[model samples]
Structures are given as structure tokens and as C-alpha cells.
Target: MTTRSRTAGPILLAATILVGLMAGTFFIFACAVMPALSRSEDRVFVQVMRDINDVIQNPLFLLAFMGALLLSAAAAWQSRAEPHRWWTWSGCAAYALVFLVTVVVNVPLNDQLASATGSATAARADFEDAWVAWNAVRAGLSVAGLGLLAAALTVRGRR
Candidate 1:
């Protein structure tokens, strides 16, 4: 194999792993975290979510969240000349969808939820259900992106 192809294989693999990591994180939030949060009293839930939002902004999570975008972009670029380019390209698009939704929908909601004052119940009413709904979309998009990246890896292997 040529040097470029050899390099593309590993880059794409790393991108797939990062995308999977993001997908798993969102899936857990949907399936486990949100359900538990839903059971909490409104004040406790709001406080817990605020704390979580603060903690989740740490460097490691940032790496995975942002790395998925950067790495997928790299993978798409590297695989551009390959026969299986569509898979990587589509993976990139899916990741973009995830990012855009998070930035446009989720982050603003989180910000609003975090800084909310007066009535926790009112905040919960305004934020929690809608946030959960947006998160489900993120979960699905990230998973789809991961699956496409996995498909790209498989196609690369076959080449």
C-alpha cells in the first residue's frame, strides 16, 4: 500500500473511535442519566444539571467533543481519493449535524438552565424536557456518524 493509504487507515480509525465515544456519551445521557434526573425533585435536578454542565466543560470532554469534529474532518480529507470516500464524507456530515445542533440548540438551553433564578420548577418546565428532546437528537446523530465512520473503516480495509 502507498504511504498515504497507510496513514489514512489509522486516521480514519481514530476518527471512528472519537465519534463512537461521543455517541456513547449521548446515549448514556438519554438512556440512563436523563431518566435518573427526571426522577429528582425540580430543585435537585436543576442544581445537579448545573453542576454537571460545569464539570462537563473540563478539558477531557472538550477533547473528545471537539476532536470528533477535527478528526472526522481529517479523515474525510485523507480518504477523499479512495473508492470509499462517500462513507467518510457522510460521516463528516453527520458529525457536523451533531455539532450544529449542540451549538444551536443544546448549548443555549444549557446556558439558560444553568443561570436560571427564582423558581427551579419553572426552569425545569422550560428546560428539562426540551433539553432531553434535543439530546436524543444528538444521540441519534452521533451514533449515525459513528456508524458511518465504522463503515468507512471497513471499506478502507477492503481496499
Candidate 2:
């Protein structure tokens, strides 16, 4: 096996784990949390979402969120000489999209939801549908990235 193959295993494994954690977190929120909140009054929805935004910023989530990108980048870098390098590169790209969507789309919506000037009804009106849509998109991207990294592991040393 090539040197890259030897190093690829661990880094790819780490990336997959982090990506999976991130994917599952987003997936759960998309499938469960938001839907459940949809039944509540707009005031409740706005309040709960604001609370979630505050609480989710903790160290553990940050570690997984940031580590997913870093390790995916490292995995892609290490896979440069491997036969399955494309898999890691693609996985990295998908995660980058996930990162971009979270920052570009979801975060702004979260901030808008956090805006104190808005009425809860108005805030929920502005935030709900768009946030849910982009969240599902990011969740899907994270899952795709996770799959690609898993594929990288599967084809690690193949010619």
C-alpha cells in the first residue's frame, strides 16, 4: 500500500465520525424539532428557536461542527496520492457546502429570529419556512459528505 493509504485510514475515519455527528444533529432538528415546533403558537416557536440558537453554541457542538471541516480537509489532503482521493475531495466539497449553507442561510435566519425589534408573530413568519428548507438542504449535504468519506474508507487502498 502507498504511504497515503496508510495515513488515509485514520483521518478519513475521524472525518466520517465528525461528519456523521453533524449530519445526525441537523437531521434530527430537521425531522423532529422543527416539525414539532410548527404546531406551537408563533410566539412559542420564536422563543424556542431563539433558546435553541443560544444553547446550541456550546463547546461540544462547536467541536463537532468545526472538526467536521478540519478533519475532512485533512482527510482530503492526506488522500491526495491515494486512488480514492476524489472521494475525499468530493466529501470535503459537500461539507464545505454544508458549512456555507449554515453560515450563509441558516445563521442569518437565526439572527433574524433573534432580532428583538420584531413581534414574535412577525419573527416566526419571517423565519420558519426558509430556515426549515435550508436546514434540510444542509442536513442532506452533511449526509452526502458522510457517505463520500465512507466511500473513501471503503476504497482506501484499491488501485
Candidate 3:
């Protein structure tokens, strides 16, 4: 490998790891925390959902999402010249799907929930179910991306 490839390879690897961590956090929040919250009484559940809505709307989540997208894109670009180009491309595609799903489905639903009131609990519940469903899809894509990253790392190490 050339000096540039050597330098870029490590950077891309780091980016992939970082994005994986962010995606993992999101998956855990949805799968673990949200489910536990749903077990509570109606009022508590609504409040928990509202709190989750607030957390998701925060700038921190936005920053993590955007940062991960950019980093993953960079990693994908760098990987094109690597021997395991397919793994890199697959990871890129998975990450892109995750972002698209979040933007298309989750963001709108989150916005609606943000505007909802106690009187609109029924509507919120409908949206929340949809959100959970979409989140499952997101989590699956994230796992795929993480797998791709791992595969790419392994391939790179052997080269």
C-alpha cells in the first residue's frame, strides 16, 4: 500500500468503529430502554415516550447521526481502493439506508409526537408503534453495517 492508502486506511477504520458505536447506542435505546418503558402504566408510558422524544430531538443525537453519516461516507470512499471493496460498499449502503429510514419515517413521526399533547395520546400511540417498527428496520441495517465493517477490518489485516 502507498503511504496515502496506509494513512487513509487507519482513519477509515476508526470512522467505521465510531459509526458502529453510535448505531449500537441507538439500537440499544430503542430495543432495550423503550421496551422497558412501555411496560409501565399508560400515563407513565406516555411520559416516558415524551422524554424519549425529547432526547431524540436533542442536538446531541442530531450531531451523532450526522457525524456518523459523514464518517461512514468517508470510510466507504477510502475503501474503494482497498482489496475488500465490496465490504466497504456494503457498509456504506447499509449506513445510508439507516439514515434514509430515520429521515423519512422516524423524523416526521418524532416531530408529530413533539407537537402532541396529553389529549392526543391516542394519536401518539399510533405513531409510536410505527416508530418502533421503523426502528427495528434501522437496527437491522445497523447490524449489517457493523458486520460489514468487521469483515472489512479482517480482510485489511490479512493483506
Candidate 4:
């Protein structure tokens, strides 16, 4: 393969894998984590969420989440001269939407959850429903983003 194609191969692969991990993480939260947390007492729930927020900031998850964006953008840029450019570009767009939602909706809620100082009852009342609802949106967007990345990879493969 040519140098550009060779480079594109790894870029696409990394982007796809990272995006997939993000999708799976969100899916797990939607399917199990949040629901289980919902059943916990308010203090336990809030504390767990605070701990989780801290834990999720670890290097690996950060690499996957942030790397997906960087890699997707790189993949799209690398594919620009190719016929399948749209595939990578669309995938990047999908991931961008996911990022947008996370930043705009979720991060503030998380910050709020973290800052809450009063009764867990009050905290849960303020944060839980809105957080869960927005999280569901994040999960859906993550899945769609992953699918788009897979489609991009398939398109790249066919070339």
C-alpha cells in the first residue's frame, strides 16, 4: 500500500476502536450502572457518582474518549483526498455531536453533582433525573457514533 493508505489504515482502526469503547461504556452505564445506582440511597448514590466521576478521569478512559476525537479527526483529514472521505467525515461529525452533548449537558451536571454539599436527598433530587436523562442521550449518540466509525472503516477497507 501507498504511504497515505498505510497511515489511513491505522488511523481508521484506532478511531474505530476508541469510538467503539466509548459506545460500549455508555451502553453499560445505560443498561446497568445507572439503573443500579438509581436504587441506592441518595448519599450512597451521590458519593458513588462523585467517586465515579473521579475514577473515570483516569488515563485509559481519557485516552479512549479524547483519542477518539483526535483520531477521528485525523482519519477524516487523512481520507480527504480519497473517495471514502465522507465516511470518515460523517463519523467525525457523529463523534463531534457526542462531544457537544457531553460538554454542554453532562459536564455541568457532573460538576453540580460534585459540588453538592447538602443532603444527598437534595443532591439526588437535583441531579439524578436530569443526569440520567442526559446520559441516555449520550449513550444513544455514542452508539450512533460507533456505527458511523464502523461504516467508515468498512468503506476504507473496500478501497
Two-way TM-score contest, 2 vs 3, winner: 2
Cα misplacement distance, residue 23 of candidate 1 (Å): 0.2
User: Model 1, which residues run further than 4 Å from truth?
Assistant: 1-3
Better of 2 and 4 by lDDT: 2
For each candidate in turn, give its C-alpha RMSD to the true structure in angstroms. 1.1, 1.8, 2.2, 1.3
Stretches of candidate 3 off by over 4 Å are 1-3, 57-60, 118-120
TM-score of each: 0.96, 0.94, 0.86, 0.94
Candidate number with greatest lDDT: 1
Residue 31 CA displacement from its true place in model 3, Å: 3.0
Candidate 3: tens digits of C-alpha lDDT, residues 95-154: 889899989998888877766665555755767688888888888888888788778878
lDDT of 4 by residue, 1-159 (tens): 788777988998999899889888888988899999988998899999999998998999989989999999999999998777887888888888878888898888899999988899998899888888877887887788788778877877777
lDDT of 2: 0.91
lDDT of 2 by residue, 1-159 (tens): 777656668878999999999999999999999999999998898889999999999999999999999999999998787788899999999999999999999999998888767688888888899999999999999999999999888898464
lDDT of 4: 0.87
